[model samples]
Target: MQKSVVVLAVLAALAVLSSAARAATDAPAELDLLLRGGTVYTGDSNEPVVGDVGIVGDRIVFAGRKAPAQFSARRTIDATGMVVAPGFIDAHTHANADLHSTDPRKRLNIPFLTQGVTTAVIGNDGFGGFDIAAQTQRLRSAPVGTNVAMYVGFGPVRIDQLGEANRAPTPEQLDAMRQHVSRAMCDGALGLSTGLFYPPQNFSKTEEVIELAKVAARHGGLYDSHIRDESMYNIGLKGSIEEVIRIGHEARLPVHVAHIKALGVDVQGQSGDIIRRIEKERAAGLDITADHYPWTASSTRFSAALVPPWAVDGGREAMLKRFDDAAVQERLRTGMRENLRLRGGPETILFSAGSTKYVGKTLADVAKASSADPVDAAIAVLRDGDLMIASFNQSDEDVRAFMKRPWVMTSSDSSLGHPRAYGTFARKYDQYVVKEHTISLGQFIRSSSSLTADTLGLKQRGHLRPGYYADVVVFDPARYAAKATYTQPALLSEGVVTVLVNGRLAVDAGKPTGVGAGQPLLRTPKAGSCT
Candidate 1:
């Protein structure tokens, strides 16, 4: 009787296991979207494979060599003759201000969308905002149209606490600044960013920055900076790079150099040296990375880039007084001449925006038109208000050299009056990867996507994998190219057929679908665990 009971129990258990297997095989994959017939280039891989991607409710449910037989979706996009890859992420940007516009059309960020970017890291140059919580809340209250990750800017914090004073922060004031960083990190800011090259932040000493960086480090955040000097300015290029490395080492955090460049005649051909130093630091176990735009020209306001920092000290009123004082005029002229020379002369600086008549004219042309010294012409333009200039100061060779480094990623450093704002990524892909062959397509995608995500400590958003957020791009490789030029800065790029952010279509059939599918990405201290 006992033997009979044991045999009966074993038979029952086998029947139950068979039923469970049947249920698993018979169930349908309830996918919301399916992209079929495409060459999938997973950002982490060096090769592409033909496959289908299945998405359901803001997450990828399936991505493999073949589509799951039982999977079906409400919408299916035919991706024939296209390469589907993870969405591009811009490591540095100034589009936060533009996205904050009251107009929804402007907020959609069509320029970025057409270039296949779904995410952008903003608040660069240490001017993101002082109150990061309020800034994020404002962004969340409206439709941002694209994914945004913000940084706590040290510049605004200094301005708020010290009122543009050019002195070392007192201990109490330094603690107050630390509090600001802590608050920002708690409020979901990605990290702390400093524009040590700009006012207020430039006034701060390295010790003060190190302490502030510690606060971000404790929260597992990054230290991103526009270094104090990129050329022949105070501290020099190598000194500035060393300063960043010192901070990262002391603070125990990752350091990201914004728009890494070899600017001016003084720093040309120094890319090899820069790479060696960075590699040495990495070998010593320091986490250092950098981003660069593809353009030889860098855009900035005339006052900030050309005017002597001493002239701008104490604020705009003081600078204006010095600009007008007869005694100081010669001194200013002497300084401006040197500045113009360091920036490759007046011929290299082009007026990109602000004054209609001066637009597209070089500084040399503008100086000649006014019959004034180029310095005087620049001062006149600045006197009207801040004006934009696209300074052609970098070497193409240097740009390519820095780009090939494994630690560097792509960034637009995008703002108004520059073609880079619209065409940076597409231009990199077309001009550098396709035409120049500086890096392979896989390397380009990796640098533009997964590498950025890893540097930023972003979780599950930069790869095309099951269980990851569905931020995807599909483009025709042969057709992908940048249309925007210096003369036509707002023109849209071509070849991106579709872009999905968080499983929602932002760009459909090469055009914006008018959907605001962006969410503010908040970084927590435990974010790395998710990675």
Candidate 2:
């Protein structure tokens, strides 16, 4: 009886094992999409791996190595001979103009999508709106083409309480500003962004900035700044760097420098010193990072570039009043003349907006055409209306220096009339990686994608890994190049063959699919902080 029972138990165990084997053989192998045979940069390494990526729903199911034979894909893209990478993330941009536009086509963000930029950080240079919740709601109501992250701008917060006055805030005004920043943090801002280089903000003292930064720190946000000086404007570049570092130390939050550059001739060779200082600070355990645009020319308002901040103290009307005063005229012109010199002369400043006659002309060209002094021509253009200029003041050496740094990621301070808006990523790839060989393709991809995402605290969005969002780009490296020029600033880049945003095809065969698949990426406030 015992022998018979043991034999029966053995038979039952065999039966159970056979059933499990059958179940394994019958398990489904299906995927929503497959990208096959591409040289993939997973954004975590400097080496490219040839592999297939499988996706289902909005997340990657598999990356690297071939998918199993049992898995069948609904659609497979033949990515042979192409480079597959995590979709590029623009660390800084002014694409909010299009993102907020009433027109659906503008909201498509075709320019950015074509360049393989799947995400854009808005509210840069301290011009971001205070009502982040309203902005998020607007994005929900009207979808856009690329994902957007927002910063609570220092400009708006200060201007909300203090008008465009060039004075320090009072104690009560300071408290109000802190409350505004705190509210914005609760509304899902990634950080507090300040354009200390710009007026009104430049007028603010360092202590005031630290106080506001503390509010963001308490709610787990960072501090992103267009530093007080990139050149010898007021505080030298080194001084400005120290200021932001001090803010990070005192406020206890990560700090990011926007459009990092040694602008103008005065600070051209200072990149080495700047890098050392930043590296030292990083070693000391402060979270410090920066972003850079490839172009040598930086864009900004014509007035902001040349006019003395004091002249614009009260606002445009006051600046105009100063312009009309003969007593102030000599002082203003002297300041303007020196400022123009510091920017490498009128020939380097090209007007890109606000006047049809001067839109395509340099300050030198405009002055020559009008038969007036360059400074006078600049003033005349300003009086007509504030114009945007592509100021070609950065040195190639300094640009290359900053580009190679691991801590410095890529960005496009995108604005109208600047080719950077349409072609920053493409241009960087073509000039720095493909042509100059300043950085390897893997380095470029990693910096533009994962490094930026990590610095900004964006989770699970920058790597081509299993369980990550399927925001990916496949491009022909040989053919990828920027077509936009300084004159024709809106031309779309070439060579991005396919783009997937949140697992949906936003671009196919180099054309925008008009798919508004973008979602507003909101940073969740620290636990219990919002309440």
Candidate 3:
């Protein structure tokens, strides 16, 4: 009897082993890459789970608790003690400046890649080109380092139809403008972007924008705007918010606020009010959202910061002509003085780019050195050339308030001489997520990735789900931080250990791989819209 029992046990054990072998053989083939032992945020959850993520070709094959024992990979990254999440998508950027460069190195987009941004939206603040197909073709021919999506800019379209004119467009011109927007939408533009805060776009009335926005809406595109006023410049911030809501309602399209902020002392501490207004609009069923960078200072042309919009109506030469007009001088100065006061004071504006002599100085410093009034010094600087200034206008309280909102996403609004170009994501993580605990890591990742993607209609990206694109980021949370500052704007971020764009490593072991794996992401127009 004992001998019989032993034989039965031995046979059962062999049967179990054979079943396990069959299961292993039936499992999917080896993965192309495996990220082992990391805290993973799937971009859909506000909580993280410690797990392994497996990829095959250009798609994620597994992204949960330990990838099965049967799964293997050709390349494996020991992601121990790291945070693995979907690669961040920048809601707004000026990366097109470099992406369009002839030099391959410039197209590498190392600044954004090092910050773990695998995709960036271009043509923001109303500057995208009208020819979406031409732009896509150029990007395809000379690939860039990060995926590029574009908006059909209101500024370019309006300028093309009306040459810096402040008056309303003629009916023929309006129809022509509508055709331009429709063609761009059919050619894969995400939406219409307008920097209404800047001239000549500021010259466009709300009704004109609504007409164009309607064209984009018919083709299933959204409206993105740098609202007409972020401060008390024209209509107040609240009025601008209402304007955006009205546009959404009138045009019947979603509206996105770009780099939303309570700029200037006049609008300081009004972020709460702005948030309430946005929420009210949202509750009223208008599709409205906004993006913000993680800095108190806002960057823009020196002239845009101080010069009255009416003075810049025609163009540079026209504006220069006004500067020489004795009749306009006192009025210009008066307007500038009020603008300067609204933006804190002369000391709060730092000249970031343009004249070498003034690049590192404040408006106050320049005024003092020139022995002139601050306004006069500003005019002198503008007359020479418009410099980029970093105006320290927002309060931390307002910044945090905007950030805490679930509707607000992250953006760089990147431009030359601004640290945000290199470090917006990292800075947000370091300051808001890590040190201050203003938001959880998962919240930060979600806002920077999936939220932006969903809002902008970027398909098949920004998540860590099976069958999703393998654009992933692995970083040392403890070490991940922004190294760039206003003075050192070009310094790269630190601690982004590995980055993959389209399943290829763009940054490996914290060093860029020099692989331009980026592709132009063109939105397909609604069915039959192209035809």
Candidate 4:
């Protein structure tokens, strides 16, 4: 009788197993993850809501209701009473460090993910990012909280080949640069990045830009530029737009205007013209897109501000020597006047980086404290210490108008640019979308997530859809806000409670779980790869 009962139990277990197999064949297993009960903002404009998002392995398995019980995992997160959206993508960043410092506690990163940034495009402003073999190796084994895609920086290539001398490349030199660009792209550069506002790259003629961009095009690369001038003053807004459009037309590649803004007091309201020009370019069939941080202030080194381009003509050491020369100092003043009248006024220059003592103070404030002239204070600061400074120059009206443009994907334009670095996403969602109601939450998420992903051609990310990476964020709209201010710029954003990247728990209950599961945006092998 005992044997008969055991036999019956085995038969029942077999039936249950058969039923489970049937369910697996019919629907996805319950899932390794099941983030349900939240209002899923999928970042898909067409169908935004989903009953649940389920994950199997590293991929999103299901994104609908009534998931099967087959998905059994060791853990699950209940995202109830929150908005589940795609993780934020910072389209522009500068995370170049000469040294990683080799100390975990002394590590300099990990604040990005805390602010809902799952991925960041590092290497901008013609910075030195060409060490792809090294950077790729580093990030491949990195412990950072987010994914990073790098661009082959033009300045790094120029600096490595030719010191920061202002001149166009020779034919052989141009070819060499192309080879470097191609190899970097092969090594995994998503695109070619240029900073027309900086030295070396700024000296490259429009034709030179097109030549490199064509190389980028041959490698399925996009051209992103910090244009010659963003302000509608002297250089004129159309000249810069013309340059990007010219690049697109010549290279037959997509061109992105990095951090589109109208600077300077006189040109503050000319954002509409910039938008019209961009639209015209887009209408003409050249793939033209732009990214802008949801902030008024743009940050850069103070040298770029007070000191003229001529002073920075050679490199760092050259500038220090020039600073000590009285005759050179006089020339520097002439250039500073041009920059002030051209770049923006003193009110726009906010001290974001450098000594903690100078963090919140502006050039005017520094002058007041030092009992010196404002421009002289700027020069002294550069000469004395690191000149990391933020320019609070953009117009709020221009910012709002630019944000409303559908083609304009939002970016931080920041890696360590104070409040914007830590609080751009939250600031937009809270102040603009939630608190102020300038844009809807769905629209905000779309621009922050899906649009950016689509803009970059990074498939399977930037959305909470089935078969996509489970890079997700959960936050309460009412509670969502950025706490980092100009005074306390290091503060993290408030109200985002959960962030997940690649189906793993990266952020649990508003804190990092210390799991870094980021993946590179795979560069597809196409005709472009061959170039």
Candidate lDDT (C-alpha), each:
0.86, 0.90, 0.90, 0.75
List ranges where model 2 is wrong by over 4 Å: 1-25
The weakest ten consecutive residues by lDDT in model 1 span 6-15
Error of 3 at 468 (Å): 0.9
Q: Regarding lDDT, does 2 or 4 come out ahead? A: 2
TM-score of 1: 0.94
Off by over 4 Å in 1: 1-24, 526-531
lDDT of 3: 0.90
- Deviation of model 2 at 128, angstroms: 0.5
Clashing pairs for model 1 are: none
Select the stronger candidate by lDDT from 1 and 3: 3
Model 1: per-residue Cα lDDT over 312-411, one tens digit each: 8888888888988998888888888888888999999988888787888998998998999888888888787777889999999999999999889999
* Colliding pairs, model 2: none
* Residue 71 C-alpha lDDT in model 1: 56
RMSD of each: 6.7, 7.0, 7.4, 6.1
Better of 3 and 4 by TM-score: 3
Q: What 10-residue stretch in candidate 4 is worst by lDDT?
A: 98-107
Clashes of 2: 0
Residue 178 C-alpha lDDT in model 3: 94
How many steric clashes does model 3 contain? Answer: 0
